[model samples]
Target: MSASHVVYVLSCADDSLYTGYTTDLERRVAEHNAGEGAKYTRGRTPVAVVHSESHESRSAALSREYEIKQLSRARKLELVGGE
Candidate 1:
């Protein structure tokens, strides 16, 4: 079976950004929306997956997540089309 891997960015209710890696992007996003995801998102609630990249492996997706997280807010804003 193919391994599921993803790097995703969520726009929280407060308009903050959250970055993470997941094996199941849909389920992870649903969890975040349900307020059962990360602690940072718990208080924010109503998170949405604004961006996602699939990778061949978990390690690769995690590496991408780190890279995305390290980007400045301006760079990230550019990535998300400044929405």
Candidate 2:
């Protein structure tokens, strides 16, 4: 897993989905919970990883993150097995 990057979906406090790329998934999650991560997540504290996808490279993870971000909420929920 260390050979690749990761794209994760976070379930926020207000029940919103947040997608992002990270090299260290555990640390990133901790950062988000600490409110020291993305500005979007700062207000959405107590975020949790509902899903994570692996990519071969940082660029690949980033591209996937963009794709996931563009997905509709319903689609995103489907991706995370919420529907």
RMSD of each: 1.4, 1.3
lDDT of 1 by residue, 1-83 (tens): 57589888888899999999898888998898787899899989788887888888888888999999999988888887774
lDDT of 1 at 13: 90
Once superposed on the true structure, which residue ranges of model 1 sit more than 4 Å away at CA? 1-3
Superposition error at 74 for model 2 (Å): 0.3
TM per model? 0.91, 0.94
List model 2 lDDT by residue over 19-44, tens digit each.
99888999999999998999999998
- Cα lDDT listed for each candidate: 0.87, 0.93
Instruction: Assess candidate 2 and give its TM-score to the true structure.
Output: 0.94
